[model samples]
Target chain A: MIEAKNVNFYYGNFHALKNISMQMEANTVTAFIGPSGCGKSTFLRILNRMNDLIDDTHLAGECLIDGQNIYDKSVQVDELRKKVGMVFQKPNPFPKSIFENVAYGLRVNSMGDKSFIAGRVEESLRGAALWEEVKDKLKKSAFELSGGQQQRLCIARALAISPSILLMDEPASALDPISTSKIEELMYALKQKYTIVIVTHNMQQAARVSDKTGFFMLGELVEYCDTKKMFLNPDKAQTQNYITGKFG
Target chain B: MKHTERELQSLKEEVSQMWKLVLSQLEKAKQSYFSGDIELAREIASREKRVDAFELKIDSDCENYIALFSPVAVDLRLVLSLMKISSTLERIGDFSEGIARHVIEEDCNRMPPQMLEDLQLDRMFDMLTGMLSDSFVALESENTKLAGRILAKDKEIDAMYCNSIALIDRFLSENPSFIHCGLKTLLLIRKLERIGDHCGNIVEEIVFYVDAKVLKHGAKQNKE
Candidate 1:
């Protein structure tokens, strides 16, 4: 479970997220949707402290994972990140072999020995829904796989760390339609184990793949509710206008 | 306006045009029946085809809008309500055409004036016309405040329909020679009653579209 309590974030004095308080349940897919620069992705980044990587960025209020404030002084950033995995918009894989790409996470963490890393690599690939495609070519270069395959490889790389929550930032935006659909299907299957939170520009994809949808606008969360109600009969007129393509 | 807004406006206009045409058909049915105008009755029957054409066009257009736009919230509700309203209007058109046929087929001229007055045919026609036209205004204005009043008018039509049946039986008992014409008049009244019910249905759809409230199958029961 993940919860944000009155979470306000700033990027060098420009407020990017304003008083956003929401809870995402375990094992359910939650989607954040809005126009560009609306703070949906910013808020998602806040969940795993990805914003800490940037200069002059500050966050106020608690970002809780399982009721523990992750920003606490005693909390370890790397340990927090290990429990929260991320997949970016573009598939940025290491220029290494396919097996090495997945094994990279476990290797860096010194997680296991040779046989342990091999079994974990295969399990992560299967978890990412890319095992069968890349099973026979484990030693081949990661660049040999397609863009969609590379994205799934990144997902597998994240899974190799054994994270509890998966943060996807437009994970299918660069892929073709068929590949986008495959990624959407993977999200549905992945929710059985991971509490998936995704940021997307596509409204229909959010409606299709999420159990809960949060609509953000101009650094403010406009509405957050059931995906069906959000699409069919949203409570706010702003949400209705935005979803129906009436907003400027 | 946005592209979707323009398309929705065009769809609303199409449904409004069809509503007006169906209203004219019902009006002409009343005119032909009372004034014994066989020519006007024939015109109503011929224009029936145009009403059917309107329904087919509106149905397909709504389908295309859904496929092309995948509308949500109000736009989605409007498209769905428009489709159902068009179909309900087509059914009303069929009843009007059926009434027009009765005028051309039955010897309505021979029916005694006193008997026609007793049947309260003019009152029933006026009520149906008012109900249909008021529902049209309700939809056009995008205001469902008139829905309650418009829906209540159907109850009056139903009461008249019930009374007309008993009145016809009394008239038949007194004058057996007029039994055939009397029974046909009862059927005509039944058609008007049905039109009233369909008008209620249209009002329900308008309420659904404009207010996002489902007024069908007894609102209270549905809410419960």
Candidate 2:
């Protein structure tokens, strides 16, 4: 469960997100949709403190997971990331074998013994729906897989850490439609175990995949509502115009 | 200019044209009923095929649009309403053709004028036509305000039908010689009542499209 209350974020003098307050429930898919540069990705990065890596950036307000604010000084950034894992738009697997790519998370976190890591790697791959495809090629380079398979491999790597939340930033934008569909399907499956937040430019995909949708515009949240209501009859005229493809 | 918008616009156009054609069919049916003009009855009968064709086309178009574009929100409501409205209009067209058939089968002069008056036949026919016109206007303008009046008009048609039952019984008892004509007259009134029912259906579909409210199955006809 993730909740943002009046979250205003900045990169130096530029305010990237303005008073964005939304809730992403456990075991559900929440999507952020808008035109490019509307600060959806900026807001997502703030969840796991990835924004903290940038210079001169600041956040003002609570980014709470469960009851505790993740931005609190007492909270460990590394530990926060372990609880909330992220997969980027590109599938950036390490220059390692498929098995090692998935095992990287467990190994970095010093999570388990060799047998435990191997078993967890298989389970995570199975959770990502990539295990059967790559079962015989565990030692093969991750680059040897197709774009879609590589994305799922990245998903397996993220899931290996046993994170309770998964933050996906345009995870399938670079893949073909078939691969995109597989990723979408995988999101539905993944939501049963992880609270998932996805950022997408495709309105139809948002309509199809999310339980709730937040439409962002000009660094502000224009509307946040049930996905059905958002796609069927959004409350705001700006949301209606944007989703209907009539935005000026 | 968007692809889904273009598809939805074309779907609305096709539905509107079918609606107007059904209205013409009703008009021809009314002419056949009043003037016993068999030629107008023939025209109404012939146009029934076109109405059936429109139903198939609109139904297919709605299905294809859903499959290809998967419209959401108001666009989704419009396509769904188009499907149901087209079906309701087709039924109206059928009843209109059925009325014309009754006209073709009987002599208008043989029917008792007093009985026609008692049943308020002319008044009921006019109300049905008016209801159809109101539904058409409501659908075109997306004005759900027209719904209450349209639904109320259907009750008048039903009352006329209720009055016709007794009138037919009395007419048949007094003039057993005109029993055949009386029964046919009763069927004509029943056809008008059915047309009224179809008009109510069309009005509900209009409301669904304009307001995103379901009015079928005796749902609250709360007007916008």
Cα lDDT tens digits for candidate 1, A1-248 = 99999999999999999999999999999999988999999999998899999999999989899999999999999999999999999999999999999999889899989999999999999998999999999999999999999999999999999999999999999999988998999999999999999999988899999999999999999999999999888999999989989873
* Model 1 lDDT per residue over B1-224, tens place: 87879999999999999989998999999899888898999999999999999999999999999999988888899999999999999999999999999988966435688877887888888888898889889888998877887778887889989998998899889988987888888889999899989988998898888878888886823422
Where model 2 places Cα greater than 4 Å from the true spot, the runs are B1-3, B107-109
Candidate 1: pairs in clash: none
Top lDDT hit: 1
What would the per-residue lDDT of candidate 2 be over residues B69-184, giving only the tens digit for each residue?
Answer: 76677777788889999999999989999998887876534676766677787888788889988888998888888899988888878887888888789877888898778878
- Tell me each candidate's TM-score: 0.96, 0.95
What lDDT would each prediction earn against the true structure?
0.92, 0.89
C-alpha RMSD over true interface residues, each candidate: 0.8, 1.8
Q: After superposition, how far is residue A228 of candidate 2 from its true place, in Å?
A: 1.8
Ten residues in a row with the worst lDDT in model 2 chain A? A239-248
Model 1 stretches astray by more than 4 angstroms: B107-111, B220-224
Give the clash count for each candidate: 0, 1
